[model samples]
Target: MRVPLRDTVAVAAGVLAPFVAALALLPLRTSVTHTNLALLLVVVVVAVSALGNRLAGALAALSAAAWFDFFATAPYQSFHIQDRADVETAVLLLVVGLIVSQLAAYGRTMKRVAVADATHLERLHGTTRLARAGGSSADVVRRVRQELVEVLELRSCRFEYGTLIGRPPRLDPDGSVQVEGWVWDLERQGWPEGEIELRALVHGRYQGRFLMTPAPGSVPPPLEARLVAADLAAQAAAALDEDAVSAARRS
Candidate 1:
């Protein structure tokens, strides 16, 4: 796969920015304290972390430490640092840079999670609104089937009415999967081979089930997402039950 232009730029900057900054500081080596120089390099690491990714940030940190030892410390033009204080400063620079990178990576992860949660809520809200609007049963089922494919990241999904034919992996309301007779650890392991079942029930009545086929080598969705899918299935069942009641009254 081709890398994004922005990422390529970031990685290049991460590796080179520290070297450039250290060279610029060469004249000030005699005037500036070693601790102050290390702090300045930390700033470069922070900038790289903000612009790029964790790997970029880490590379920046390593580059900064190496250049600092070579150009700014005693035994100049070499990696070896004779001064103990300079040695401490070099080690600290690398440590601080790594920590900043990890924190940046964590912040990015939280942001993605927040966006995903909002999307899940919208899917649930839309389905509930449609059901309340007196939409047709087929419409409700169709909408739910589409939503399931998205929420669960399934390759394909279809609804089956009435009797369930055979034993398949069942997605429970609590987000646990019952396979054969045991619960599968979905987090560590991805979806099992073959089709999975998501049953839809209304007031203890077996309304229907959704047969979902997982994509080959697809990552397993989180528990929260699985719960949202189950909720959507429930909405479809409720819509079907409402239609059944209306037909019975007419008869």
Candidate 2:
């Protein structure tokens, strides 16, 4: 898939801003102490984090540290720093930048709900249209499962609605098992056959489930992942309902 233009721009800005700032301030060598100069790099780190990911901040931090060591410290115009204090200050710039970047990353997670909602909304609309096209319950479910695998980029996705797609019913605490009753699992292993799993529900009733292998080495947060699964499962259930009603009308 083509990468978004906006993301490319954000990453570019994050990576280049530190070097640009360091060069812009090079003429101020007489006025700014090396220690004070390092602080400006920390600001660049935060700016990069705000604009992009933690990796971007780390890149900014490393770039800024190099500039600090090369131009701002005593024994200037070289890679080496003579003073112990200056070395520590340089290290602190990298450390502080990394920590702040993490904080910023966590802060950005606040948007996860909005992002999840939008994703589910789009899928729901698409599936509802597919349901209107009329397919058997099994066929609708297969399409839904395929949609889940594609949209979430899972390793695999399997769904079963009161039939054998795999083993017997393994609720793993079930969708209605929790206090507020939304699908969840504690094992972190996706339910049926994947690293992550959740029960499917239709109007708060158990209908089926999806076992999804999370992308290797990556899984969404538990709550977010569950909600995403719920949304996918709900789509499957809706499709199944549409199929059943269509069959009934024909019969």
Candidate 3:
């Protein structure tokens, strides 16, 4: 995989930070045992993991252990470590630092998941209320359209009952998920022709389509967005169906 420049920089910084610190603290080599230096490097591993991803943290840990062996072990200033205890200490540092990095990365993942789940719940709850509101058909459609744009965080979104318009949907007929091709227009800063449509099928009756233009690179995570869209589509189906009933009764 191609690594981004920012991530490469983070990994380099993670390694270099502890390596440089080991060099500067070399003056205390006589007083600080290899064990003490290993402990100090554990702190460096944690810090690097906090700032960067797990891979960067692992690299930082290995760099710290290697540098500790060269600068702080019995055969000082060389990769060679003559003492068995020092060898064990170095191994512990590497293992412990890896564990710490994994935990840190896991924590970051959980935090992001929590935030996303909360947003999804809030969006669905608000849409339910909006769909259930009593109003003219046009006002109901307009409100739901506004909710669609806000909930999906899109540049623009619209809804209309009946079949999807213009072209075939991005997804296969049986699929509910889509993230696909777009050709941008400079003035609009978005796709001029391409759009994605999520259909609302209730009781085997296709109610309508939610047509939207995504902001550049703003697609949601694949699984979560699809599940939420499926749920949202149900609410959309109900609202559109009601709007149709109202329009018929008023005529």
Candidate 4:
């Protein structure tokens, strides 16, 4: 479990401040026994702040102040303050605790944001790599399926072209060609097990449909799949147009 940086710092300060105060007051030689005891008291405050939340920090601060008043002053073991300085010291300790906690919380937020940005950059890089791999529509499909299975950990994937009757031929599960307008079912073994119908786009035209069935109870397909699908759709459309042009020339 990640400890929020703010909580850690706050706790550290709470425990350290009293001992520091005692040390600073040591030169005065006001009360050797009382100062030593005050150092131990501050240590407890620090420990409490580290293990608890904002409420704990506040409680630790308050307890430290009370302990100091009761044991450190000339009026030993009493809450009465002998001077304005002592009162100010108690208030400052509480303020320090609040400040430390705030800084720690801010640090946690920044860390989370940084992680999110890194993930976005990674996806962009993957898409760019896919585009640079030139190939026929079937090759593109194969490459994409392989990438999805390997990188995205998808179980299976395929592309279909056109409507059942009028669509272009399909690249089957085994990577073989079949009649146009056929439905290709893409399946995976785990979570998010469902199917989506896709119509092939050729040269800005719809060539056919593609579909996939996610594994039972699998998590929903991530956004990356949709982005990849869009890219494949564009490639499919271009491939169909090329095929049509080739057939016309032959005829």
Candidate 5:
């Protein structure tokens, strides 16, 4: 379980604050007052156990035990566990801390995972909405690019058409330059040290190839983007086939 920075800070503060407070109350110490102080240290242990995970809680408990022994107990400041009862108390404190921390940590992990899952579901829902909105293949392609640029904050995107013949076209469709595929300098983007090509296809016919140059040192395209592109290609092919059938029937 990854602990958030804020939670880690809070837990550290929880562990330290009581010790600092106990130190401040040292001037008022007598035999009876010292016993109360020891009890207060135990409270700190319990609190830390409740708030942290097993490891953190156990550490906190150990820290509390050591502080109590060194600062509050008799013979005034030494780690000598002279009595059997003191050893038993320390053992009990450690066990309690471990159990509490484990439970708390598990709960925190589950909550975090649930939240992440919910956010992913929401994104999926948005993508589905975009896919369902009806439009011409070109329009749909533009919309997909726009969504990716806006939501994913990509530097640039292009769609290339695959060729049926020897080589693919190395340019974007005439009017849709900014919104479509264009030749891009791969070296500028520091991509895998080789030339890459993008091709657009509709109904098994080659449309064109687009070259993409992502920002230098940018993360690679995600699997989701590739999947979305595949889906868009399939949709465009179907749309084109339907249009061709209609045109043939009219002729």
Candidate 6:
């Protein structure tokens, strides 16, 4: 498996950075207070945490604590500390570094979620605009098919007009999956085998459905994405209903 370059850099830095930093401070050990030295090591931990993930941050914290004990404490170059204050400083350094790493990880997670939400909104807006453009019903169906494939991470998607066939896993508007009259644990089990159906309805009457074949071994899409796909299907059904009404009036 190919590892990401960022991760490789992070891991290397996490292990080596504390040693380099502590050695650099060795010359000033007699002049600098141990508390001040510990704070500097904490800064090194923070930098590694921001540059990489939680694992990288944790490695940095551990490295920073171990190096601080060996290089900064009494009996120079020895892990044993004669002073109680120095030992406390080393303990606090490790604890603070760990807390900072967890916070950094949380911040990264929130950033990713915000980006995903924005993309979902754009998909919905684009589909709504196409449906309102007064284009042919075929055009709307085609556009929706493309969106469904992307939003659901499906291998393929197609529109089926009128009449329900054999029962398959059904994607409800609420983003739950129903199979054989039972609710499938979609989030835990991923998509079931075979095709799934997302029905398009107007005022309780069926307009059509999109038969979706999920990509094998693909992670089940999040609820927010599934909801957006359902909304897109509703837009397609509304457009088709309007086109049918226009044809009847013309005749």
Which lDDT value does model 6 have at 20? 97
Output the better candidate (1/6) by TM-score: 1
Candidate 6: stretches off by over 4 Å: 1-83
Spell out the clash pairs found in candidate 6.
none
lDDT of 3 by residue, 1-251 (tens): 23457578879977898799789879888998777878888888888887778788888888988898888887787899889998899889889988997788678768878988898798788777765565544554565567656655678877767655666444323334333444323223322345667677667678877787766655343456556756777676777677667789999
Assess every candidate by TM-score. 0.75, 0.53, 0.74, 0.37, 0.47, 0.73
Candidate that scores best on TM-score:
1
lDDT of 4 by residue, 105-213 (tens): 4555466557755654564455445545644556555554454443334455566654554434333323323343543332322232244444556545676555544
Candidate 5 residues lying further than 4 Å off, grouped into runs, are 1-18, 21-55, 135-251
Worst 10 residues of 4 by lDDT: 184-193
Candidate 2 vs candidate 6: the TM-score winner is 6
lDDT of 1 at 143: 99
TM-score: the better of candidates 2 and 4:
2
lDDT at position 98, candidate 1 = 87
Candidate 2: C-alpha lDDT = 0.66
- How far is each candidate from the true structure, as Cα RMSD in Å? 4.6, 7.6, 5.6, 12.6, 10.3, 4.4
TM-score ranking of the models: 1, 3, 6, 2, 5, 4
- Residues 139-166 of candidate 5 have per-residue lDDT tens digits of 6556544544433234676655444334
Any residue pairs clashing in model 1, and if so which? none
**For candidate 1, lDDT tens digit of each residue in 1-251?**
23557788989999999999999999999998998998899899888888787788889999999999999999999999888888998999999888987787678768878999999999999998887887898999999999999998889999999898999998999999989989988866778778999999889888999999988777778888999998999999999998899999999
lDDT of 6 by residue, 113-166 (tens): 799889888887887787777677898889999989998889999999989999
User: Which is the leading candidate under lDDT?
Assistant: 1
Q: Write the per-residue lDDT of candidate 2 for residues 112-180, one digit (tens) a residue.
A: 657866876777676667666765567667777777676656678776457435443233332222322
